[model samples]
Target: MISVKNISKTFKLYQSPSDRLKEIILHRSYHRVFQALNNVSFEVKQGETLGIIGENGAGKSTILKILTGILMPDRGSVNIDGKITGLLELGTGFNAEFSGLDNIFHNATYLGLSRNDIEKKLDEIIEFTELHEFINEPIKTYSSGMVMRLAFSVAIHADPNAFVVDEALSVGDAYFQQKCMQKIKAFKNNGGSIIFVSHDSNAVKILCDEAILLEGGNVVQQADPETIINTYNFLIAKRSKGEDIRYQGDDTSSGYGNYMVRIDDVSLQDENNNPSEILISGRPAKIVIRLAGEETIDDLTVGIGIRDKFGQDIYGTNSFHLKKKICIKKGQILLIEYYFKEFNVGPGKYTVSVALHTGDTHVNECFHWLDKSVAFEVVAGGDDIFIGFVRLKPDFHIKSETGNKDD
Candidate 1:
């Protein structure tokens, strides 16, 4: 378990090296103070995973460094129940000139393992990395992903009571990432505490028990993974528009945009055009998005995303993909309806996320984006028995043919 209380850190930035000398001589302040973290506090109990997410320069790295003892906070305190390890960045605590095998021994020894203990766990670590062929290769010769594999392998095998993982896990390939996630899950099941920092919302939602959002060195919100991720998205949208940043606090829906277009309302409807919180599988349904224009805009593409209860995206599409372009003038109210002839998804609770942007994606010029605007459940009444999140309407054919028997 890990506990952090009212932690704060600040850095002094100088415009030039000469300013430091001048400040010392004149006993004057010649550096600008940058608050990297301010009163940040959180806890990770045994068997729980806490995720930290924020934009760049929001003190995510600073907080991690403090938690891992790499940097000292100017105020507050941190307490760890047992040995803690961290995977902060690629090649951290590694000697570039040393071979992978040598680095394994080196890192394990640093983790408080005896030579005998290192020898016993050496093979297991190497096998987990799948780097047997390159175990003797110099660390300088390995790729970034390879270094990440070696580092993560050694860190996890150190048998730490709690581990802090930054964005280092994002370096490896998808297969290795999945392998690491499985290992993390096993560790969590064994009552290990984890503090994961990443920009991957889906991974955080799937793995974390709770999460916190940081902005400008302050903890903006702390809550369940779903709520944190929604607020994070909203924060990004607000940043893109140069708007004042504040926590929306509403988990049901968080909306943000440039104000040129506003998502006034969103609703899920059934075949009879009645609002519904429940929909039937393989039945006709529609999502109605009401938009009010604050200014004239062209090249607008409206999109919708369907996410499962776990926050995994099921489907997403935009008007650009459908070859539709919209233009709205000031005071114009538009009602966009997406009709589904067959909602062929399995029975489950899902949410509808709507966005109004330019071009094909919301990466640039996002006029409005609303997350979890509406929610509905799909029932199994109209569809055949299916076992997964989606129905493919598979067609099967059986043919009988007799072939010559082999001698």
Candidate 2:
């Protein structure tokens, strides 16, 4: 268990040596202060995996460092009920000059493992990482991926009560990632607690039971993993739209993929093909997505998601699920319509996003088409009192009237 209360971290930025010299030389009192975290707080129950997410410089790593005692907060406290092993950064808690084998022993000891205990698990760690050939080599000579594998192997093998992980597991190849996921699942299933921090939505959806969204060093929202990821995607969408409100590094763009896909429009209507903004709960609704292909797309599949105003994904559908082929010619215009019963969804404004993905690949081939277009709301005047993204009412009745005697 972990409890963070009013945790805040502040740093001082000095312009130059002269600024510091002047402060001491002339006894000046002026100083510049930077607030990294401001009154941030959260609680993680035992055996819970809480996904910590935020934009760059949003105090995500800061919180992790504070929790692991790597960095001290300027104010507030972090109460951790058990021992913690953190893989916050690559090559952080190891001796680079030492051999991988030596560093493994060193790191294991740092994680509170006795030399004999570490020796007992040494073969398992080496086998899990598949780094036995390079185990004797200097850690500095190891590649980034190799080092990450060794580091993770040592940490998880120590069997700590709590885990603090960043994006460190993403360094290795796909095979290693799969192994790490399996290991993490096994660890959590064995009642070990984990605090996973990452920007990958899929990882959060798969591993985390709950999540917290941080914005500008503040806690903006906290909820289920699906809701947290949806809200984070919405924030990313706003940044991509070049909205007026900008967070740190919002203007920076990365060369993600060779090709990019964008959604032009999203509409919802009835069977008559007439566009209707409002829909009654528990009715059938058709969602139409219009997408434009900027380049020649081969074997393209579209994945669509519907989310509420709070950024909770109510439903997700994709063409791949239907085992359909998507061969779009160069600069082709396409319309994709998904029909489903709109049951269990509460009344709220929702946004629809469509992603152009390569067939059979889990990764989205194109830049995520998140919050591409906003749709209208569904009123909650139905008899069911369910409050969720969808409204599904299952029928339940007595099978035999004779068996059901009148009261």
How high is each candidate's TM-score? 0.89, 0.64
Residue-wise C-alpha lDDT for candidate 2, range 7-77, written one tens digit per residue: 99987778776788788888875579878899998887777899989889888888988988889998998
Against the reference, the lDDT scores of all candidates come to: 0.89, 0.76
Best by lDDT: 1
lDDT string for model 1 (232-289, tens) is 8777766665663333326368776676888899998998889998998888999999
Clashing pairs in 2: 343-390, 343-391, 343-392, 344-390, 344-391, 344-392, 345-389, 345-390, 345-391
Poorly placed runs, candidate 2 (over 4 Å):
15-31, 240-407
Error of 2 at 309 (Å): 19
At residue 398, candidate 1 shows an lDDT of: 58
Residue 142, candidate 2: C-alpha displacement in angstroms: 0.6
